[model samples]
Target: MGGSNTSHSNLKNAVLAFLVPLPSILFYLTFLYHYQDDDPNLLSPVWKWCYNHPILLANIFFFFNVNVLFWLIGLIQSSHWMIDPYWTVIPVLLVHYYANHPLAVENKYNVWRSRIVTCLTWVWSIRLSHNYFRRENWQWGVREDWRFTDMKHQYGKCWWWVSFFAVYLSQQVFLMGICMPMYVIHLENKQLDILDFVGIAICLSGIAIAYFADTQLHDFVSRNKKLKELGKPVVPNLDKGLWQYSRHPNYFGEQLWWWGLVILAWNLGYGWTFVGSLINSLCLAYVTVLVEKRMLKQDYRAEAYQLYQKTTSVWIPWFRSPLIGKSKNT
Candidate 1:
């Protein structure tokens, strides 16, 4: 009876999580559909301004519908969990928006590129969303990310205002910045070439790596949980498969995917789009440090993890370093 009730409650939460963003999505779709006709006279002053500035429109929508609205919802729920799922989702939305915008030139080549990129974006989104749900045991909005929780404790009363900037607004910048490639791809119409194929290969490889790494990590955690339940000692660290070569194969993969998109945009003569991927990579580097620090803080795992770190590459997969013996003279 308890198990059945838990399943039912999980399903309910999943449904609610899925529906929470529907209104905002619907509004965006409706706006895009109307904007497609491109009749300046038919649009309101606000709409006209938005039509003229598609990027600005996206930012405005994100600010109001996402930043402000989600912040309020987070306050009410006392958890900022909703944004984690949307991290996977928002890129899909942005790609489609760019593809459909008046600014996008719809030549045969452009349409083909857009379709290919959009499909890949969807694939990435699905993989990430599935991982998130699985990691959360299909529950949603019940807990905040550990980083956010830590910040909350650190900030105390200042968290309310600090979160607006640190959590929501910061995300606004990063998401928009990282998605510049999608916008550039739509804005410029170029013939498909070798670089496009290269980008596709890199993007797909990233997705595959991330999928496998996350799966392995999830399995490790599950196994550890079971061991704990049975009163057995849990493995201190995972040092198998892809993890053997890199401490964060998943982060490396994610970076490859974004950099791949930047390649596509660069091929289209918008090399500036590389800035987004670069910034994202830098942020990920910082996150990797934080994650390692947290891992070392775990007493049981610290010594083993430290040895693993010494031998393992941080991001890129490479040959593990040999352990050096200390010299008596030294």
Candidate 2:
């Protein structure tokens, strides 16, 4: 009975997450369409100026759109999960906007670059958004991320404002930084070459690896939960397959995916801005540390996490110790 009620509540939360911002998003899109179309009566001088600068218009729209949704959901549910899907969704939107620009269709090389980047980004975004939806059970506002919960605990009442500036805004800044490649890629007409092919391969492989790792982890975790609920002996942790090789093969794959984009940029001679990928890698490293720290604090799995950390690579897939020999002996 208790489990049923909990499940029902979770379903409700997920539904609310889907429904809450949907109206606002629809309204915003309608407004944006009219604004971009330059509806004669509704067009203010400022908006007309904005339409002339599509990038600026897009940046502002997304910034406010995300912020408004975050604030609404955060205030209602006190959770940060509503922001999860935007990380994948935003980049695709950005790239799509640039890809469809009139100039993008003018040159053969530009069209290829635009198509490749957009298609790859769309593929990645769909996969990520699917993963997030499944992982969160679509309960965006209800399933607050543990990191945000910890911050709330630390900040007490002030987390409301702090989260806006510290979490949401900072993430937007980082997202824009990493998206520099997509932004600048449309500026050049460099034909696709061997490096671009290599980049595409690497990007696709990274996505596959990450997707596989997530699926494995999901299966293991779900099985563990079911065993626990059935009052049976549960698996200690997910330490088989890819998890055996790295504490975070998914994160490793994620880093590789960005570096793959960097390779695309480098092939076009868009140098230095490839630093975006480096920044993304550094951010992923920080997130890995945070996740490991959280896992270490779990009373049931602390020692196991420590052992895993010592034996497996943190963000790279490899064995750090002779666990193979120990396993064979056992």
Candidate 3:
């Protein structure tokens, strides 16, 4: 009976934790919509400011959402990872809004670009959300991420408040910065150019690589799990398939996709939009390095990973290490 009660309490926390941030975010977005629906010239000064600076308005939305989540995490004793899906979800909103924006939709070329970008974003969002949901188990606070748990231990109790600045707000900044290309795309490149076609190809190819890389990793993990259940020898790490060519194929693909977006932005002449792709790439590289460092310290099959690392390219698919095929046993 005690165990049952504990489980019920955890369930209640999880649902309530997830619910805490909805009202603030939804209300802000609704306000934005109402502002947009009004005549821009006739709007009051505050509405006029929001009308002119849509990105600022979006950032405010993100800031409020993260602050709410920050409070909720403390109140519910949940992990900061509960905010993970926002990375993919916010882009869906921004892209949809940008693509349908009155200024953008009237231009035929930009409309086509917006449609393509939006469709690709939706596909990316669906795949990412599906993976996050299953991995997080929809249990919210009950299933904390290992990374945040480790940080909490390292930071002591102060992580309760520190996480708002270190994790949630920082992530919000990166997300908005990385999404600048989507906003920029709506404003310029009134006509399609050769670079636009090239960008589309690159973006599509990157998305394909990322999709397949994730799929391969998922299938391998599932196979190993089944093998373990059957008392058969299970593989330790996935170093074959798309992974054989690159140590972090999905990370490379993710960076490539952003560069493709940057190319689209470049068509309008070099500007702040390029910062989005550049920072996003740098951040992803940082994440990849962090993950590799963590795995080196903790993975049981670290020796196997070292051997795999010798032959595989770190990010570029074709640039094999000089030590390639040096370890015949691998």
Which pairs clash inside model 2? Answer: 14-139
Ten-residue segment with the worst summed lDDT in candidate 1?
321-330
lDDT of each: 0.87, 0.74, 0.73
- Candidate 1 lDDT, tens digit per residue, 120-206? 999999999999989988776557889999999999999988888888998998899999999989877689999999999999999
- The true-versus-predicted C-alpha distance at residue 52 of model 1, in Å, is 1.2
Estimate, for each residue in 77-183, the C-alpha lDDT of model 2 and write its tens digit: 66777667678777886787666543344588877777888888988898888888778665444466677788889998888888887668877777777777786
TM-score of every model versus the real structure: 0.92, 0.84, 0.85
| Each candidate's clash count | 0, 1, 0
Q: Write the per-residue lDDT of candidate 3 for residues 198-317, one digit (tens) a residue.
A: 988888878888878887887887898899899997786787788988988888877777778778877777566777677777877777888887767756667777776666788888
